[model samples]
Target: MTGTIENMIVKLTGWLSRHSIDVLRVSLGLVFVAFGTLKYFPGVSPAEALSVATLEKLSLGTVSGYAAQFVIASMEVFIGLTLVTGKLLKTGLVVMTGAMAGFFAPYVLFFTDLFPGAPTLEAQYIFKDIVLAAAAMVIGARALGARLIPAYERQAPVHEIRERVAA
Candidate 1:
């Protein structure tokens, strides 16, 4: 019975290993991308929740703010697409982790003081992005083709494959 249970566990683990990365990449990556988009396209998400005034403090200029928002969102979408395709999951995830922090930094550093009435807003925004960053790091460390990602199982290149076959 113990052996049977162990075998079942292994099978389940393998199944998850085969599927979870794809599942997470598409869903989570798309969500982040959508968020980045909504940052600029007003009413694209929940109404008035993200105030224009709050964004003004970034001091990057009106056009710069919108550009930053759209560019970040575009990157989120691009990364999500790549992750879903599994073409560059680690690179996408690593880039996204940095990007999320980059998006959150202005609010955490400058905008927090603007909203004395909403003390927790800064904390919540910062925490959420940090969690997203952690998730991105996990994906980066585990997905295939990620040699820098130590937990992944790396196979040799095609030339090496031919040599091993000959040996």
Candidate 2:
């Protein structure tokens, strides 16, 4: 019974190791695409004002208003498409690094707004980016050829194992 349970656990973990990164990448891509699509419509995205404000501050007033939103939206959509399609993924990861910096900049530029005592709604929104950023990092590592290997599988040649593993 113990051996059967261990085999089941190993198989489940092996399946997760093989597919989790791609799932993370696709899910992150969907999030970006959804948020970016919201930005295309004025007053639709909850982050619209904050995003525009941050862009203005970051660009030193050179990029503002609709133009700032457009640029942000375009960049996000491009990143999303690349990640989702698994094409130009390296470029997407590169762009994602820059976009993540921009996403976190509001913490520096509008510290008061984000934390006016307790955390504001906007602060909550920005905080969620931490998970997104981490997910992107995992996806980026995979894009660069990093992989998650199950310990049992790593112990010996996979073909030598009798248990069938899901790819």
Please report, in order, the local distance difference test score of every candidate based on alpha carbons.
Answer: 0.58, 0.90
Model 2: per-residue lDDT, tens digit, 1-167?
87777778878887899898888898899899999999999999999999999999999999999999999999999999888889999999999999999999999999998999999999899999999999998998898889898877778776855554432
Model 2 poorest ten-residue lDDT run:
158-167
Write candidate 1's Cα lDDT for 1-167 as tens digits.
87566555545655676767557667777766666566667556441243333334444445344555555567767777666676776677667766665657656555646356764654455556666666666576666454331121245465753443343
Residue 87, model 2, lDDT: 91
| RMSD, one per candidate, in order | 7.4, 2.2
Best by lDDT: 2
Give me the displacement of residue 106 in model 2, in angstroms.
0.6
How many clashes would you count in candidate 2? Answer: 0
Q: Which candidate is the best by TM-score?
A: 2
Error of 1 at 126 (Å): 3.7
